[model samples]
Target: MDLANSGLSGEAVYKSTCIACHGGDGKGAFPGTPDFTKSKGPLSKNDAELLSNMINGFQSPGSPMAMPPRGGNVSLTDADLKAVLGYMRTTFEK
Candidate 1:
């Protein structure tokens, strides 16, 4: 998917890019991935911190793999990241 257009909604971006690992339920499909449904999971962090982590990439403490910069999609803009972050919070945060 060419995200260069910047018109995709957060849910769309998530279904296309994030769902592979984060899973549709936000429980994580991969080993060591954080559980977004947890009350104190990764979503507990403030937006700025979350954005920084998403922008620069992040590796959970025990995760065997790290999320590449921009979730490996260089075409995603800061807006897209924010949108997806909001989506995750609304849909998954407990």
Candidate 2:
């Protein structure tokens, strides 16, 4: 599928997997929620690190909810994560 069509599916992936806490627009509902629209937080991190964190929950000393391993949704595949990541990047990474 084209990027546009792929993105459409990606939107669904994002909604089902990320919308609760990240908000419908990926703006986040609570504090510390990364504002995807504003490109805030650790945007400087490379894609590899971001992908790693997306696959494996961060286990640092200060993480809340332990980042919820794969954001607590295990059914997602790597492609789904990539699609969701692409969606977030397009939505907020401006």
Q: Assess candidate 1 and give its lDDT.
A: 0.88
Stretches of candidate 1 exceeding 4 Å from the true structure: 1-6
| Candidate 2 overall lDDT versus native | 0.68
Best prediction by TM-score = 1
Evaluated with lDDT, which candidate comes out highest? 1
lDDT (C-alpha) at residue 1 in model 1: 27
Encode model 1's per-residue lDDT on 10-93: one tens digit a residue: 898789899999999999998898899999899999999998999999999999999999899999888898888878988998
Candidate 1 shows a clash count of 0
Clashing pairs in 2: none
Off by over 4 Å in 2: 1-8, 59-63
**Which tens-of-lDDT digit does each residue in 14-80 have in candidate 2?**
7887788788866677666666676445445667787788899764344355567777988877677
My TM-score estimates for the predictions, one after another, are 0.91, 0.75
Q: At residue 65, give the lDDT of candidate 2.
A: 51
